[model samples]
Target: MRKSQIRNPKHRTENCPLSPRLNYFRIFLTFARNSIVRDMTFRANFLIDCLSTITWSLMDLGFYIFVVFRQTSQIGRDTGWGEWEFYTFLATTKLINGLVQAFFMPNCEEVSELVRSGNFDFALLKPIDTQFLVSLRKIDWPALSHIGVGGILLSISLWHITQREIDPAQLTLLTGVAYIFYILCGVAILYSLMISLAATSIWLGRNESLYDFWFYITNFSRYPMEIYSGDVGTPLRWICTFIIPVLIVVNVPARILAQPLAAETPEARFLLFFTPAAAVACLAISRWVFYRALRSYRSASS
Candidate 1:
């Protein structure tokens, strides 16, 4: 037998507790490095992928500038989501979505194929958590290019806001800190949602529509939630804000940095507190659902 096929017994001991957190971090780095090398080998494919992502993002921005921004100065009722402010919100959404797609989307989308081909059995034999191994095994470097575009958009918005004196007082040190923290929370919430959907593949056997379902659900999150606050959209706002919680992911961080609510208002206080709380709750629920799905998994050999 080739050495590559050999499994070192010392790699995993049955009596050992959970894998060391540091070991998981190292393993993740190894996976990312290998994926980068693989993508580099296909230089043409890599370039095409990168160009495609940048083109789509630019087109989306252009649509807003030429179409929507030309028609209205604000999205909400005098809430100040002007051209630059709304662009900042769009940039935040892109940054969050970019990270998720780069790190988790490829792996999550591959889950059904893994199960169907029995490749998941190898993942289960690994020392680390199966979900972690499966989710982080691949990184899409091209997808991450959106982060650069997002950063540029964000910088332009910040400069424009300062130059125009659009509530410059709201951009305080505290607000900056809160914005960063909530951006992280938003990312966490999105990751939780993606992984949970991926976990469903274990039971469904083949969930090829994962991307379609995910896009449909998260499409609502791309715009300002205030647009959904009218009589026709109030129920949607409630469901997304309280039940699903995806709307708050980008809204909180965007609002904090763009058009902040009055600190003295009850609604503002609720949103300020609810953003972090929702992150924690969503993560806990998703983790439970993932593990439960794993427990119910049955290998093809069985």
Candidate 2:
């Protein structure tokens, strides 16, 4: 047997170049850089991915132009979310979705595979937070094409709104801030939902339905909540608004920018106030679920 040497606890800490948190931040930057470089190396695939996303966005716009504009003047009878107004809402939805897809989707989509392959054990052993590591380890730069499309759509909608409205002064700094704030809120809600679903892979062994589940839940947010208002849509409205809170994610931000909720129903007011709270609650619950799942996880060797 080799002679055992006594190790000084201070040695490692003193020799470290950065604090634990700072080092983790540096690692995250490295991961982002590496992902960008990797995507650049596959130039053809990256360009194709970008083109596909832009094409899909155009198709979605065409559907609204043909179907919605042809049939109805506005989505809701009472609320003033007309063509350009609804377009603003759609644009906001696109921006939020694009950011989530670019940053979180690829990583969350791989969580089940990592767990099934026993690679998650390596994540757990890292010095940083496992959730952060799993969520941001990969970035899909091409998926961010929607953000540009959304900005263009938003600018057009805003121009229409200014031209149509009697007083274009409604687009104040406060309104702009609120829109940006709630866009970030929407992203947090989506991340929470995705992480919660990814965590389920711990017990289920494989969660092949991650994307399916995500799409189903977020699909509810892509449209105006007003469409789901009548008796036929009441149950769905309540469930998506109160229970899941997905409807509030897009609606709150959209309303802030496209149409102010000054004269809206009492229920709408309640949801507007509750959105920020809902974001915090969802994030906390998802973090708890993720850690709980990790605690119960066993390596493949076991």
- TM-score for each predicted model, relative to the true structure: 0.91, 0.91
Tens digits of per-residue lDDT for model 2 on 18-125?
886677788888998999999999999999999999999999999999988899988879667788889998999889999999999999999999999998878776
RMSD of each: 4.6, 4.7
- Per-residue error (Å), model 2, residue 234: 1.5
lDDT per residue as tens, model 1, 1-302: 21222233334544656456666788889999999999999999999999999999999999999999899887777766878889989999998899889999999999888887778878877656666787889999999989988999998987787668536624779888988899889888888888899889999988889999999989989998878867879999999989988899898888877776543368867988998999999989988888778766777865
The best candidate in terms of lDDT? 2
Q: Provide the overall lDDT of each model, using Cα atoms, as 2-decimal numbers.
A: 0.84, 0.86
Q: Evaluate residue 208 in candidate 1 and report its C-alpha lDDT on the 0 to 100 scale.
A: 89
Candidate 2's C-alpha runs over 4 A off are: 1-17, 165-169, 261-266
Q: What overall lDDT, based on C-alpha atoms, would model 2 receive against the true structure?
A: 0.86
Per-candidate clashes come to 0, 0
